[model samples]
Target: MQQACTGDRFFTFYLLDGFALHGFSAAVEALRLANDVAGRPVYDWLAVTADGQPAVSSCGMRIAADRSLAEERDRLLRVAPPRCIVVCGGRMAPPPDRALEAWLRLCGRNRLALGSFASGLYPLARAGLTDGRRCAVHWEHFPDFSERFFTAKARQTAFEIDGSLYTCAGGNAPFDLFLRLIEADLGTDTVNRICEIALRERLRETGERQRLPLQARLGTDNAFLIRVIEQMEANLSEPLRLTALSPASGLSRRQMERLFRREMGRTPARYYLDLRLERAHLLLLTASQPIIEIAMACGFSTASHFSRTYRERYGCTPQQTRLAETARRRAGGRGNAPEMEHERHVA
Candidate 1:
């Protein structure tokens, strides 16, 4: 159904528990600037929580709700409901919300432009709204999201839009998505002005990578070394042999070994092991996949070997990492998880 004689395009943002304040604020500010530049309210929005109370962000900030999910569902029956209903999410994977899922199903049938970003996309994907649609989630949560939502064609890009559904990976990625919305409704000129007002350098186009380039990350301009690392990331699950990786760099094993030690401060084998362990660490904290599965996914042939090696490097078993994260979340995601720094230090 078409919007009922709506002068301004309206949006209803249903902010989930522990939603990312950065992305949510970016979206609101983008619309506010669009109205400022256009000399009128080209867009209108309302922020709501699950139960009509203020939402707590991942960083522990409280955002007041304009309405509740129940209220928003009732409003959908009235004339000119929001042109889009965006779900804001945070670092935590959302638990099952039957009400939200059912409401999302209704949104899909209503032909409303549904939107979500970060871990928030879980509900849309879980609700079956993203079936056969392209979607993106934050890189930190990508492993879990991809494993869980096979029906949704998941991408590691900044954002994805298939017909009326728009999904973004978390952080500043959603800023680009919201700017594209403004450009669609207003024009390129309006979007440019909005970016200027927001002090944004430029709008990141869709399909751009959610992660920094390998060159930037490694802080090295050695093309051969970078190529080797690229292959390592691409083949994390099965893992490429050092002999095979040497061919990627056109170097003898000894030459490549020196390169790894010089640049990364670790032997090639140690570096490869660390890379795989880093991925496992992330999966352990953010996902609930079984230990054996996680071990295999990270190229560990056995869970015992994975556990022993994990303990040697991180000073705890994989089980401990997951348990600590669960404890932190139960504590309402307040302070950082003790093992979080270990993962962050991964090169």
Candidate 2:
């Protein structure tokens, strides 16, 4: 029986339509690296869709799968049940197939581990798998996920691994999650080897932040300044004036000004303008909007003002930044290309 078996650990990747292409790709590539570096196949990955059809990603790319859920059920019965199942996709709930849910329930009962990436948390929540377990979700979707499922403990972290439930913040965190998994199941030596082949910097430990660092995020150290920065980020498309933020934060304008100068090393108005410029930079890269449109969207009074400030902070005009990002995305690939390379270098 042992001789007939092909590999030890079966990793079933459930590819839901509108799955995040980057998240799934990062996971598969990480596993591939682990296998190659280990000098033996430690994991066997099989992509599966509901009806054995190919799956499409939210980014409009299509990927073929190895089997259907039904066929997988038969295979599981014949061999060892899958040791791990990874759900990958967007905001949609898990397919409302009762049989599939039942299969997962049985797998869980039998001690199989499970994980979800990005908005894939929706289905896991829908299947009642995350109830009572702490899960990490993409920050953008946390509000909606929390509202929809009150039974689970969801947070904006890089990843959460509680017992058999593993959830990662979407985007690049899958690489970290899979690397951590390799280190947990195989060994640290294997993870380091995989990292070398994948060209990834050392796998970010779970202790590292899932988001930008606090100092970089706020661009300052003052508590009040940080709060104002948070407020600006919370309302990027619709920014607030110094006067408005002062009243909202219960600080007089003079006090706010003093706090900003002491902590952020800049006036509130300048800080807020930089924030707007940052938003404009992101829009310019990801959206195909005109510079004027982006300027207006980010609350610039006029395109000329937006362009001047953008150039000062970014060392290039908004159009130039967008062009550079576009070129990088084309050369490498969509998704993993650094979103704030220009600004990071400038700052």
Q: State the C-alpha lDDT per candidate.
A: 0.83, 0.73
lDDT string for model 1 (255-329, tens) is 998999899999989989999999999888767789899999889999889999999999999888888888876
Writing each residue's lDDT as its tens digit, candidate 2 over 85-184 gives: 8888653333356766776776677688989887667767777899998899776565446657789998888888889998987788889988888898
Q: Which ten-residue region of model 2 has the weakest summed lDDT?
A: 338-347
Candidate 1 residue pairs that clash: none
> What is the Cα-based lDDT of residue 120 in candidate 2?
68
Question: 228, model 2: CA deviation in Å?
Answer: 3.7
Top candidate (TM-score): 1
Candidate 1 TM-score versus the reference: 0.90
The alpha-carbon root-mean-square deviation between model 2 and the true structure, to one decimal in Å, is: 9.9
